[model samples]
Target chain A: MPLPAPSPNPNPAPPDAGMSRRSFLRTSAVLTTGLAALAASLKPLLEMNDFPTMERFLQKYYKEMTPEDMEKVLKRIEAEVEKQYGIRPHVRDLKPMDGVEFVYCLNLTRCIGCRKCVHACVAENNQSRNPEIQYIRVLRLPHGSLDIEKAEHNYAPESVPEKGYFYMPVQCQQCKNPPCVKVCPIHATWQETDGITVIDYDWCIGCRYCEAACPYWARRFNFTKPSIPKERLNPDMAYLGNRPRRQGVMEKCHFCIQRTRVGRYPACLEVCPTGARKFGNILDPNSEVSYILKNKRVFIQLKEELGTSPRFFYYFDV
Target chain B: MLRLVLCTQPRSSLVAFGGSARMRPVEGDALTRAGDPMNSQTRTTLVLTGLILAFLALTTLFISNLPGRPLRQPPIPLVNTNFLDTATVRRSYADLVRAGEDLSDFDCYACHEKGKPPPLRYDTNQNLIVPKEHSDIVMGHGSHGRNNNCFNCHNETNLELLQTRDGHEVKFADSPSLCGSCHGPTYRDWEAGAHGRISGFWDRSLGAAERKACVNCHNPHSPHFPSRPPAPGPHPLRPVATASVEPGPNH
Candidate 1:
């Protein structure tokens, strides 16, 4: 039998050889539409390069990054901060030195209810100025009561230490078993070796689980974009610390990481009018925190039942 | 068409299967492995050489395009305005002692040592000694129903030195000790980092630690902790309605 010339089909499409042109056109049209849809969806993912959204999306957990990657990220952030705010930004990735565990103890007996610590903390930590994110809240408590719920945070008195009231400034307790760290959906926040619970602001998705989990009401949510005057912004900022934070992130006092890690008192302790605020390495035997802890009647804030084991202490001296 | 060779074929038979520049239809086994001119080793060598050349080129491009060496930034000068009022940070005793004003700038020997063998028997009750020169001295210290006089706290023998309750002479630099004699508990609290103002470095190893003297904060005349207007309080977007405590200007 004389065989017909082999069909032009490369494989088993021999049955549809007559309608090849129409079938090919239909297949091409479907592929083109599918690719177009994919490109449209991908456009959002690509166009966010201007806002660091792409970088944030691709960012691995902090510990996963290689040193070179970390260096590139830090440099990129430094350029961003410098460009956004008209000041040089020093974004440092500092390690907690060996044998240094930070602690802060405030003397309720000596706190004069002056909000100098609060203001100093805001300015030093690069907190938002207009909507006013303050890490320290000096609560005026009626004498003979330790009820924090009854303690007034916005109490503005004519004079401080109002005859029957004592002032207690509350900030992040920096718990050893931090509930804030525990509740984060992503590992954006973690407790440092030195007992500071630091948040990776860029890594944070602003889910606010950490904010809601805190017992002391320590964390502050950045609602709108933070507004800090360029002149007042502290250019010296740590990577996980007072580095000007973005909106939708959660922030609290990291015990002044930029200053404290380099062996300086926190801004609150530095500017405390009454010397009630004391911060130091608890591991160092001769630290002022050790002296205060040993000699005063010290106590912790809420979490008695929660058992967060906060490093921040409240002490009263007779 | 995919099987066609270009430029030139090898030399041999006209078919070129044996090496000659000619095209000829042949069976599947016509092109044997050995008919190829280049060996496996040569192919690998060429591939590796090309790969190495490509890698070197990429490395050179990357190295040349790297950011230039970092130049050290000369520190931008900052104004040293303090975070708060002078109440938060006063000139330390070390600062005052450096200026040689530890003696409270009182020229004491002019009146008390008027004789060859000055009997420094200045009576505490003699308040009218130098009314013109000492008028600014507020005697309001003893306003709490006690008729205390100058020599009560000032050493009569040496007017420059503070007198302690145990009749011990305390240099003005050692005023905390002198005050500790009377306000024992507060002095102990101050010593324990609880009472007084400690400015400057928390780690004493860093720099000269500044601890304010008892007299630095409290006026020795009044000796009461004077209350001042606190800094402006929290300015939340929604202003908090303060509870009905006696309203004052600090709010």
Candidate 2:
């Protein structure tokens, strides 16, 4: 009886079995809107100036790159710098030398706070002229107080060594236990074997956690596109040093990595008129930094309580 | 729901507060009964339309009354300043003597006759008169003006050489040794690369580390550092001028 005849079907199939006109129109409308929304969401990426080429975008981490890879990367960087600055830069990847540990010593009695080091660093590092990024900040502190919170970094006295104050030029401490390195989620910055902390600008995602973590306020973030005058741009650049940094990267005092790794004095140290700044290999017993550390009596690190064990030492000539 | 019912019904018809009362259907109420559904609906529609129109009108007025957004100005480029004068800061007497450049500035024989020392002249106050030939030299070597005698640093026997307190003659480039006779500790520190600036390789095997002589930074006549205008302060990204102090005299 059940197979006798098929009762009149409740609903008949349409001519187009796969999809009806109304459903097709609805699906197309949803998909089109979705695709348009997706495109709109991704619009801001087009404004990024940092990732100019695929080679730069896909560059390996600093430690992961071999010498061959570094050569290619260095050449690419040189080309990019030349294209932007109108001068061919000698960008070399200088590795740390064996048995050399860098250390910096500042003589508090001698520093006059002329800020020559500050401008010299800007000039040597190819820092942005308009925005004016300086690695060194000369703080004017009262003689009676060691309070850094009360220190004035923007004092523009007619002359330095102001009557009741002492000058302390603060930069990256290059701590043995660096908080900035610890806070870098992407491992963009790390201390080298030679005791200088360096940043791989390409690997940095610009989260700025390291900036927040630095107790010395050393790390500087590039908020705008960095612009250096072509004539003033420093052509001698290193992979981890003063290569022209892009818009959204972090940079700091790398102990003049380009110069220091190749057995040259840092630009800041060379420019200091008072001879307050001293840098040398601490491992060498005869080095000046070692002499200062051993002989100078009133030695102090800026923030020694934090256990950063800063490589920078400040001493008085009592 | 309770608020809607209360709004729709007359005030007297409610038995309890909104919390205790159960919601009722909004369809056949006293307000609906008092007038035809079409008339009531038309009134509600007119009220809603008027409210929306008022809101939109107020929003437009408010927006128009608001102050205009301030346009951000681009940062002015820093002007060229002669703050990093390396020639003045890093002058090495050794480099000058080695290069055999013009020594007229420091040459005693250029002004004074060779093999004859200029007579030391003293003013009424016993301050060295610093003869007209060397009038540019400001004598402020000692804090108390006790060591201002020309003979204290100048060699009387030979005009070309400088003499230490112990009578040892020194070349112009080797004047640091002469300075050591008086400033013993400072001289020691300088020899150890602690007192004066060194501007070359830290590692000696790789390159030469040029140590600036004592006279390089300090004028031998006036040992005190002269006051001068510092480099310009930082201009941060926020656009606020952090340094309120204006540029002053470079003395």
Docking class of 1: incorrect
Tell me the spans in candidate 2 whose CA falls farther than 4 Å from its real position.
A1-43, A49-52, B1-71, B79-81, B90-95, B105-117, B237-251
Best by DockQ: 2
Interface RMSD of the candidates, in order: 13.7, 9.8
Best by lDDT: 2
lDDT of 1 by residue, B1-64 (tens): 1112211221212242223322332421243343564553344335444544554555444444
lDDT of 1 by residue, A1-318 (tens): 999997652323233244333234333443554565565555545534346557766877788888888888788778878988878888887778788899888888778888888888888898987677889888887777776666777776677767777888888999989999988988899999999999988889899999899988899998767878898888888888888888888999998888888777788887776677788889887777888787777875556668898898888775
Give the per-residue lDDT digits (tens) of candidate 2, residues B141-239: 998788877778878878667898778888777889899999988888888898888887888888997878888888888888766778877765465
Measured with C-alpha atoms, the lDDT of residue A110 in candidate 1 is 78
Query: Residue-wise lDDT of candidate 2 within A67-158, one digit each (tens)?
Result: 99999999999998888878999999988999999999999888888898898888888887776788899988777667776677878767
User: How much is A192 displaced in model 1, in angstroms?
Assistant: 1.1
